[model samples]
Target: MIWKELKKQWRFMDGVVIASLVVLSFVPLVVFSMNHKENSAKEGNIAIISIDGEEVDRFVLNEETKHKEKTYYPGKDKYNIVEMEGTKIRVKEDNSPDQIAVRTSWISKPGQTSICLPHKLVIEIVSGKSSDEKEEDDDMIITY
Candidate 1:
């Protein structure tokens, strides 16, 4: 019935446009799925902890990872507590008022992230690199 109504009000060009838009919508899904698969295939996922845009620590998210919490001091009296265990990580506590990162709970996927703007802290999960890949990237530079 909907198609019949559309047919009466629409022309061939309209149908072509709608079909093109529908196909276009799936293009991004396909692209993102491919990228996700590539990242998820890494041997182990890694959680990167950054404060003020500099990486301070990284933890391998795997079954053997110990259950522990670490406190980071980004600035004077500004701190964030991160906890990790069994392939999952989270911001357990922080000095930020909003507590958004803490409420984000645990993140286990490669692309998940938690940010605390007030503390300038960020925790992100990323795909792990093999030894050869790590060696190749060792030359990457950092600036002051």
Candidate 2:
């Protein structure tokens, strides 16, 4: 009896609705899939250090780079020591009281940043980008 009642109400529109729903569920799969470009041999990762919103130093990050340390003076008697080695960069030491940037160590990927707000300094990592392309993506929001 239940089967007979269901057959009486079901129509062509019901099949259409079910089919459309199935198709709509797959739309996200096609829409959200992204193609990632492999890093080019000619281009390598770079780290940029800035003081008071101006770039002060830039370094190519890779295993070939020598282990080095550079100190930046952002204000009177205030300094930040940045270290780079083997494709990784970090704030080795700083005069800031909280020592937050110093504690966050070894950033080695695109979009990673180490900021010393008190000293008005920033270090940002960029991957496979030219100068112009880097400027455009400065405001990009990277989500997990």
Candidate 3:
């Protein structure tokens, strides 16, 4: 009688093992399908344009460009530091009368140019081209 009960329990256990194997086989397939769907919906095209004086650089970014900001260190000359925004720019200056012009244009959108410079640096912005000679004596310009 005990032998008959053991045989009956083994029959039910065999079915449970087969059911688990079937469920396990479907798990990887489900995961792969979801991953494929997500990858297909991702964006793959983006571009960034950078220009410094006469030099131009262009490249692509994997993400969208809702907004962007860039700072350029032309050199240690303090007069070369520039910040650009969309087509607008601002340049820093010391007490130099050299004509420095910065032009920025986006390749993706042509016909848009931005010019930026310190108010004191622009010849038209300032009256009679006066220099900020006192600025050189400020505490900010002096270093220990």
Candidate whose lDDT is highest: 1
Q: Candidate 1 — which pairs collide?
A: none
Ranking by TM-score: 1, 2, 3
Where model 1 places Cα greater than 4 Å from the true spot, the runs are 1-42, 131-144
lDDT per residue for candidate 2 within 1-144, as digits (tens), equals 999999999999999999999999998776544321235233667899999999999999866889999988899999999999878899999999999899988898778999999998899988856889769858977899
RMSD (Cα, Å) for all candidates, in order, is 6.5, 8.5, 22.1
Give the range where candidate 3 is weakest over 10 consecutive residues by summed lDDT: 121-130
Worst 10 residues of 2 by lDDT: 33-42
lDDT (10s digit) by residue, model 1, range 63-143: 778898999999998888899988899999998889999999999887899999999899999877777987886997889
The TM-score of predicted model 2 comes to 0.63
Clashes of 1: 0
Per-model TM-score on C-alpha atoms: 0.64, 0.63, 0.25
For residues 18-127, write the lDDT of model 3, one tens digit per residue: 99999999999999778644532352222223334344333222234334444444335434334333323334333234434443322222223333343222211111
- Kindly state the number of residue pairs that clash in model 2: 0
